[model samples]
Every structure is written in C-alpha cells, then in structure tokens.
Target: MIELVACDMAGTTIDEHGDVYVALARCVEEIGVETTPEAVQEWMGADKVEAITALIQAGGGAASPGIVAAAFTRFKELLVEFYAANPPVALDGVEEAFRTLRGQGVKVALTTGFSRDVAEHLLASLGWSVAAPGVEAGDPGKVLDAVVCSDEVPAGRPAPHMIHRAMERTGVQDVRAVIAAGDTVNDLAAANNAGVVAVGVLTGKLDREALAAHPHHHILDGVKDIPALLSFPN
Candidate 1:
C-alpha cells in the first residue's frame, strides 16, 4: 500500500508556463543569448540555475560567477515584470485534489524546480502552499509530509535527487508504494530514475503521447484524478 505521495508543482500541480519561460527568455536576452521556445521547453523541470547553465552549454558558451549573477538579476527582473502585470493561476481542481489526498490519510510531499522563495510564494498565494492553507477546525493541517526544493538538490529533476530527497524525508523506501507525479518529461524522468511510479498530468506543457512515450506509469488529465490513482492495489 502507498503511504507517501510526492507531487511536483508547476505543470503537474499547476500551469508550468506562468512566467517561467518568459522570465527565462528575458534573462537570456539580457545576456545577449538568443533562446528558442524549444530550448526553453527542454529545461522546463530543473532548477533556474541549471536551465541557465544548459542555455550556456547548448550555445557552446561558458558561465562564470559574474555571468551567473547577471543572468539571475535579469531573470528576477523578468519575473517581477510578469507578476506586476499578471499573476498566475492554479489548475482546476488542484486545491480540491490536495484536500482529498489529505483526507485519505496519505502523507503528501512536494517537489518543484522553482526556487524556495518563488515556490513558497506561489504556494502561499494559491493556498496550495507546501501544505493545505486552512488547517484549523474543519481545515486540514499543511497537506504535505515534506517538501523538496530543486535548489535543495544537487542537480534537480531528470537526476532523481529531488525525488530521492522527498522520499528520504517521507521515509518511503518502497518505490512501488510511492507515486511520483509531475507535468513535464523531466519530472517523469525524475520519477522513473527514483524507481517510483511516474504519474503524468496533461495540464503541463507535455501532452499525453509525449509523456507516455517516456515510460511514465500512468497519465491523467489533471491533479484531480489523484484519488482514483490511490485506489489501485499495489
């Protein structure tokens, strides 16, 4: 039986695009690097620095402390620009889905590629913060058993570090009893690397065929289907 759940934010739990790539492009542009949507799409589920690094490497460029700092400055600038004009929206049924999982006695945890500050802000505003928002009286306590930030990991998704960190925090050793959910190919890859079941939701950038083709265990339309996922015998 599954006792722990490790879910990913951005695309898996919410829309992946929401200012991420926009910020990326802006940062790359500021650094005089030309980036493409396809390239941005490749780094969708890793830490911000890793994405920037990938951008640098793909173009046969090198990054030093100075370049890294400059890119981050521009990235933050773009993020502020995005939020100043347009806040992001969580996917439909995301809140309810988290609530339902908490009610089912599942120990929930979160893994995300965004920085701790950005992830916390997004979660706080969405009420899907690290755990559920309202956890008093009729409310549930923070829904998550733990949280693993990409920055906290050595490499980030597609590396299995984040998932392993969450699993370690939750003390879940049996991969079969764990369901790792996300919305990107890298997320799926991370889950697979950890030897846990990969559950892909379509709300992220990658669609069903693409996600499924990558060896994910299950594919769903959105986070709302999580309850159904828990019902299966393991």
Candidate 2:
C-alpha cells in the first residue's frame, strides 16, 4: 500500500497556463541572453534561480550572482503580474483525487521546483494550505499533507532531496510505500534518484514522447488518473 503520494505543483496539480515558462524566458531575454524554447523547456522542473543561472550561462552570458539575482527578481515580478491577470486553477479532478487519496489513509503532499515564496503564493491563490516541513503530519482537513519547495531543500529536482524531504515532512520512511508524480523529466529523475515509483503526467510542458524518453514506471494522462492507476478501493 502506498502511504504517501508526492506530486509536483505547477503543471501536475495546478494549471498555470505555462505562464511560468514565459516569465522565465522573458527574464532571461531581458538580461540580454539569447534563449530558445528548447533551452527554457530543458529547465522546466528546476529551481527558478538555478534555472536562470544555467540559462544565463547557456546563452553565453556571464552568470554572475548579481545578474542571476536580478533576473530572478524580474521573473517573480512577471509571474505575479501574469497570475494576477489570469488566476490559476486546480486541474480538473485533482482536488477530488487528493480527497480520495487522503480519505483512504494515504498522505498526499506537493513537491515543487518553485521557491517558498512563489510556491506559497500559488497555494494561497488556490486557497490550499499545507503543513510546513518538520511537522509530524498535516491536518487531514487541509488539501495537502505537506509542501516541499526547492528552496527548502539543498537542491532541487534531478536531485532526490526534495522527494526525500517530502517523505521526511510526512514521516514516511519506507521508499517502497511512496510515489512521486510530476510532468517533467527532472521530476522523474528525482523520483528515480529517491528510489520510488516514478509516475509521469502529460499535463505539463513535456509530451508523452518526451516523458517516455526518461525513466518512469507509469505515464498517465494527468494527476486525476493516479487513484485509478493505484487501483485504490472505491
């Protein structure tokens, strides 16, 4: 039995309309770095600051601390404006899925590449509350058991820290009883690194083909399909 399901936020649970990527691209371009869709997509599920730094270097710009910090600040500003104009919404059936999983005694947590501020803002906009790290458990009445952000961990996706941190936050020790699901390659890589069941969803930037190229156990249409895939009892 799966004790916990660690999910990604932006594309997996919330439909932000890909504005995050647009904001990232704009920030990098405003820094005078040439970036392509492919370049931006490659860092989709990564820490925003890290993504900006890499994008700067990859685009042949000097990734100085000041430059990266400035770009990140701009990205945050752009994202806030974008979200204010077009509020985010939970993906269809995701809340129901969360309820079902929690109702069945499974702890559902959200893990994201976003920093704490951005993650909190997104969750607040959706009116979702999550338990902070180091808490033994979360309130069952809340939408999520815990939320682990990239900033909370030493490193983000492509590293297993975030997933491991999620497990720690929820007090789940056995990797065998955990599932990590997301919509990008880094999500899968983190899951794989943590030695859990890595499930990929097509609700984000990557397509079925792109996700298939990475290591994953199950590829589903969206987060809504996780309960069905898990074969949870009705």
Candidate 3:
C-alpha cells in the first residue's frame, strides 16, 4: 500500500501559467546573458540560485556568487510581481486528490524546488496550509501533511533530498510504499534516485514525449489521476 505521496508544486499541483520560468528567463537576460527556453527548461526543478548560476555559466557570463545572488533576488521580485497580478490557483481536482489520499490514511506532501519563502507565498495565495515537520502532527483539516522546500534540504530535485525529507517527515519507512509525482525530468530523476515510484504528470511545460525520456514508472494526465492509478479506496 502506498503510505505517502510526494508531489511537486508549480507545474504539478498548482497552475501558475509558467510564470516562474518567465521570471527565471528575465532574470538571466537582465544579467546580459541570453538564454534559450530550452536552457531555462533544463533547470525547471532545480534550486533557483543554482539555476541562475548555471544559466550564467551556460551563457558565458561569470557565475560569481554575488552575480548569482543578485540574479536570484531579481527573479524573486519578478515572480512576486507577476503573481500579484496573476495569482496562482490549484490545478483541477488536486485538492480533492489530496483529501482522498489523506482520507485513505496516505500522507500527502508537497516537495518543491522553491525556497521556503516562495513556497509559503504560493501556498498562502492558494489558501493552502501544510504542516511543518517536527512542528506539528499535521492538521487533519489541512490539505497537506507536510511541505518540503528545496532550500530546507541539502539539494533540490535530481538529488532526492526533498523526497527523502518528506519520507522522514511523514514517518514512512518503506520506499516501495511511497510515490513521487511531478512534471519535469528533474522530478522523475529525484524520485528515481530516492528509489520510489516515479510518476510524471502532463500538467507542466513538458509533454508526453519529453517526460517519457526520463525514468518514470507512470505518466498521467495530471495529479487527479494519482489516486485512481494507485487503486486507492474510493
């Protein structure tokens, strides 16, 4: 039985309209380093600072710590402004899926490449509250059991720390009983690295072909399909 479900935020669970990527692209461009959409897509589920540094290096600019910091700051500002004008909303049936999974005794967690502040901001905008590990046992009324941010872990997606942290937080000991779902290659990679079932969702920028190139056990249309795919009790 699946005891835990670790899902990604932006493209996987929330409909942010790809504004995060736009902000990332603009931040890199403002630093006088031209970046392609493909280049930006490569770091979709990575740490923002790391992504900015890589983008700078890929574009032949010096990825000095100071430069990376400035770019990251700008990226945050851009995202905040964009979200203020165009608030993010939960993807169709995601909350229902969360409730369904939690109702069936499965823990639902949101693991993101976003820093804690950005992650919290996004959650607040959507009026979602997740219990913090080591803080609370998780409110039964909350949509999520826990939320693991990239910055809280040693590394972001493609590294598996966040997923591991989620498992640790949720007190799930068996990797086989955990399912990690997301919309990017990094998400699949992270899940694979963590030795859990990797599920790819089509709600993000990547299409079926792109996600198929990665190591994933299942690729669904969206998060809402997860409970059905898992054969959870209805």
Candidate 3's TM-score reads 0.95
Compared with the true structure, what per-residue lDDT tens digits does model 3 show for residues 104-209? 7888899998999999999988888875544332454478888999889888879989999999989999999999999999999999999999999999999999
C-alpha lDDT (0 to 100) for residue 200 of candidate 3: 98
Instruction: Note the residue pairs that clash in candidate 3.
Output: none
Which candidate, 1 or 2, has the higher TM-score?
2
- Candidate 2 lDDT score at position 107: 85
lDDT of 2 by residue, 13-59 (tens): 99999999999999999979999999988898889999999999999
lDDT tens digits by residue: candidate 1, 95-134: 6666676666666788988778777777675555444432
lDDT of candidate model 1 versus the reference: 0.76
2 or 3, which is superior by lDDT? 3
What lDDT would each prediction earn against the true structure? 0.76, 0.89, 0.91
* TM-scores, one per candidate: 0.89, 0.94, 0.95
Q: Candidate 1: where is the Cα deviation over 4 Å?
A: 130-141, 232-234
Ranking by lDDT: 3, 2, 1
The best candidate in terms of lDDT: 3
